[model samples]
Structure formats: structure tokens, C-alpha cells
Target: MAYTTLGDTGLDVSRLCLGCMNFGSERSWMMNDRDASVDLIHEALDLGINFLDTANVYSTGESEEIVGDAVASANRDELVLATKVFGEMRDGPNGSGLSRKHILDQVEASLDRLGTDYIDLYQIHRWDDDTPIEETLAALDHLVETGRVRYIGASTMTAYQFTKALYTSDIEDYSRFACMQPEYSAVARHEEANLLEVCEAEGVGVIPWSPLAGGFLTGKYERDGDPTDGTRGAASESVRGYFIEENWDVLDEIRALAEAKGATPAQVALAWLLHREVVDAPIIGPRSSEHLRENVGAVSVDLSDEEAARIEAPKTPRWPAAGKD
Candidate 1:
């Protein structure tokens, strides 16, 4: 429930953001029940978790709708709602991308679906290779002017793409992304390439997704144990791929660290991201309320410097991208 500044936008956001990717059924593997969804949203709100992340492409916009309706009854001023466009909305040549037409149209659609007059944060879900960056930036700027979007951000963008967008925004005087959402975790540190440095230099807030590396840091899937259980850890090809032989030693080291801290591996993992200077919010997506509680407890569970240095991850500087505050 702790709040921090969201990058350069100056909006105070919760340290733990509720990722509503599973709010709608079609686009999510875990989130399906509308009642549970509402309950979970309320739970997040009760915990002072004011930040919620959704996308227009999630479940073809079902996620946004659910979040919009779920938070509608809550204190409007107490929440910060975020959604993204730039993906195909439906089957069509122009159903997706960041063209002016698509961005403008999707903004309205997202606003209407969420039942909110304005969005706290609007983002491009991914880079639109086909659309010109200027077109997208201008359209986003228009949204800002009209009060439909308070701030804009970009997600899943590479170092070059993010930098290009930043440069374009500076020169063109258009709406630019204030935040960057990328994958980061103990097991995955790929973003450590120049992206983190660029974010730091550009003053873009870092909202990391999958801070647990898709349940890999939960410390459940051991190499010596049964491998298949239909768990998020077992079902993910990336998790399987990330689960290499050397990681066993790495995980053992982490297990020792977790034991010393008197916390679960997931708790220690999320705490690492929370304290990381570059991270503004570490997105936490739990399947159930219990999981959510366990993850939330990480915010208060402090890790010592020695315990933190014991985690097995890529060599420093190879990927400084994983940990988000």
C-alpha cells in the first residue's frame, strides 16, 4: 500500500500495482471469475493499492471493462487506473497499431469500456512498427490535451525503440511516455541492456512486469522434482528455458537467503525489486487472495545486503533491467 512517484509523471502510485491481465477470461489464464475479480479489486483497494494496470488488447478489452466497473464504486480519487492501446482490437487491416485512427478510436473505446471519463495513464502496449512514431505521439498528446489521458507510457519496448520515442517526443513537442513496462525478475535480467540506463537518463519511471519471472522465483519448480504440474511455472516455456542447470545452485543460494530472512522465496524476490533504486512499482499478479497477501507482505519484509547479494542472476551490467522499485 506504500505509494511512490510514478516516473516523471509526478503521480503517486502504489509500490505494488494490481495487474488485471486476468480480469477478463479470454485473454488470461488465471483471471476469469467476475465475482472473484471484483473481490480481488476491492481487496487491492482495501490494501491501499491504488494503481491498476490493464490493456485494451487484454481479452480483447474485457480486462479494461472489468476494471472500470470494479473500481467505479470505489473512491475515484483514491485510484490510479492505467490501460494501453496499439494492438489489434479486432480482425481488420486497421484493427491495431498506433496510427492516429487506431489510437484515437481505442482511447474512446477504452474510456467508455472502463466507464471513466479520463484515464490516469494511457500507454502503447507495444511498439507499432507499421505506424510512424510521430503519428502515435501526436495522437497521445491529443488525448492529454483533451483530458482523456493524464500521462502516456510505452510497454515492452526495446532500448532503441524507447530511446527513439523519447527523442521524438523531445523534438516534436508531443506526448511522450513517462514510464517503461518491461519484464524483470531474479531469473530474467535481459532488460539490463541499455534500456535501464536510458530510462535512468531520460527520467522515465520504471514499472516492471513479472517481477517474479512468471513464478520462477516462487521457488517451487526444482530441477530435482517432478517437472510437470500445469502450474504457471511448469506451463511456461520461458520458465522451462530459464530453468537451467546452473540455476539450481543459484536457487539454493536464494533458498538460503529466504530462510535467513524468515520469508518465502517470493517475498524475498519481490522485496529485492521493491528496494531496487530504478524500479518505481513492481507489478504483482497473484492467482488468489492468499497469494496476493503473501506477495503484499514482501513490502515490509526487509532483506539484508548479504542475503540480497546471494541471489543467482546474470552478472551485473549484463542486465541491470530486472529490479523495479
Candidate 2:
């Protein structure tokens, strides 16, 4: 397991972060039960993956509880435990968003659920248009000052919003965003238009989610037929969005490269991101121990520059608003 610093911080994290979205019993889509969740967590730790990411809203907080219990026996100092805020945790307006009330309330709740006194990295799940960025940054600054959160991060927002947040933090002398969690993969390189460059220039670490395009880049789905039954793409509309023809073409290239290199398509896809200088880690959510082990192998699947270009050559054009040819 290769390790790197989390963004600009000195904190060390694995190249692969174990996403805990698949843990918990409340969600039928999440296949892992308490015992299974514990076992997978152990498996991940055994494989040298120290970063574990969960959210306050995953399984309505049950995922955090399971993760908490799973890692209770591990050496806490060796792990980089992360969770997110800005999700509705309960009834009422105060339950969500990046409002001061929501962030403060959610962090405490997340800490309680994760069975940890301090979160290594606490991220805002998304942009909160309703809340003032000042209020949100100020509140996050307080968390870092109070030692409840060791670092702060943002996810899936535009470069403009991220830039504003960083500027606000600097001007106010508040805690700045140290990392970004974007949706990036061989099939989804939209972040390259601006977000990736911005992070690279600003020294913010990039940790992408859905590195396999929610299993689309795994080459398990057929181009001419419906997705396999019971898979995430088959059941969720968001995951199903990757079924476009262009992505299939990209997947074809990925498949060919994986075969030539004696690697699985998932490893090839992840390796593409791993080889990039800007990406700090790619979060991998596996429902089973077998999947976890397979994903871990991606760290060693080195990609030559030409092969990397082949995997990314079929990218669809970014939106017109990005202003790139």
C-alpha cells in the first residue's frame, strides 16, 4: 500500500481510501451487515489501507457506527479516519446544508457515530447554495481550532466555488480546504477542464470518488444490453448515467489495455488515476473482501504515458461553460 500526504498537510494516508458507503443494515443497496462490515474493515487495514471515509448521512449514520465498531481494535494512530457533513441527518431545516448550525451539529453527531473524538479530515459533502460560505468556513475553522477536526475538505463542487472557499479562508485566517473529492476516472475526466489544474496549482490534494465510473469502467456491463441485475448501475439512475456510448468506447480501450497488461479493467482504470501527479488517492467502496483485495492491487499497476493517453483519449467534450477547446 503506497502512502502519500493528505493534500498540503503532513498527515499520511493510503493511496486507496476505503469508502464506507457500502456498510450498514438500513439500506438494502448496502450489502454489508455488521459482521461483514467489520471483516472488510479488518481486511482493508490488513492490506495497509489506513484512510477510511464515511459520511454522516450514509445509511442515515448507521454506516459510521459500523465503521466505528469495525476499527475499534486497530491502532487508532495509524488510521486517517474521515467523514463528511452537509447532509440531512434528521427532520427539520437544521438537519442539512453548510449552515453554521448544520456543520457544528453534524460534526458532533458524526464523531459520536464514528466512535472517535477527532476526525482526521472532515469534508463538506457538497456546495451549500443556501448558506453563506463565510459562515460555513468560520464554523469549520472553529472545529479545527477546537481539535474536533484535524483538517477540512470539499467535494464535487465547481472550481469557482472551491476557489472562493479557499480565498475566504485565507482572507479570514480560517481553516482552508486542504483537499478535493471529485468524480474522476478514465470514463469521467470532466474535472480536467479546470478543477484538476486548479488543485494542482493551488497545492490542494485531489482524492476522487467513483474512480471506476461506478463500476462502468470495470467492463462488467454490456454495451448492447441492460446492466446486470442487482448491480448499482442497474438499480440507480445516477450510476446508470454512465451507460452512454462514448463511455463504452472508453471502456473498450480500457479493456484492451487491461488485457495487454495482465490486469483487471478496474485496476487499469484506478492505475490511470494513481499515476497522475495531482491525485492523492482514489476512494474505493467495495461491498466484499474480494473486491477490496482486487482494488488494492491497483496501487502496483503502473501505466506508461502512452497507455494512459490511450485510456483517456476518448473523453467527451466538457460543457461549453468551461470554455476549453
Cα-based lDDT for every prediction:
0.82, 0.87
Q: Could you say which candidate leads in TM-score?
A: 2
Q: Kindly list the per-residue Cα lDDT of model 1 for residues 1-325, writing each as its tens digit.
A: 6789988767999999999887878733567898899888888889889999989988888888889878889988878899988877889777999999998889999999999999999988888889889888999999999999999988887798898899999999988788999887666666767577788888898899888877777888888775557676666676666576555655677677788878888988888887677889888888789988988988898866766666644334454343321
- Report the number of the highest-lDDT candidate: 2
Separately for all candidates shown, the number of backbone clashes (residues 3 or more apart, or on different chains) is: 7, 0
Model 1, 152: alpha-carbon shift in Å?
0.5
Q: In the order shown, what is each candidate's alpha-carbon RMSD?
A: 2.7, 2.1
lDDT of 2 by residue, 190-221 (tens): 78875888899899999999888778878888
Clashes of 1: 7
Q: Which ten residues in a row have the lowest lDDT in candidate 2?
A: 316-325
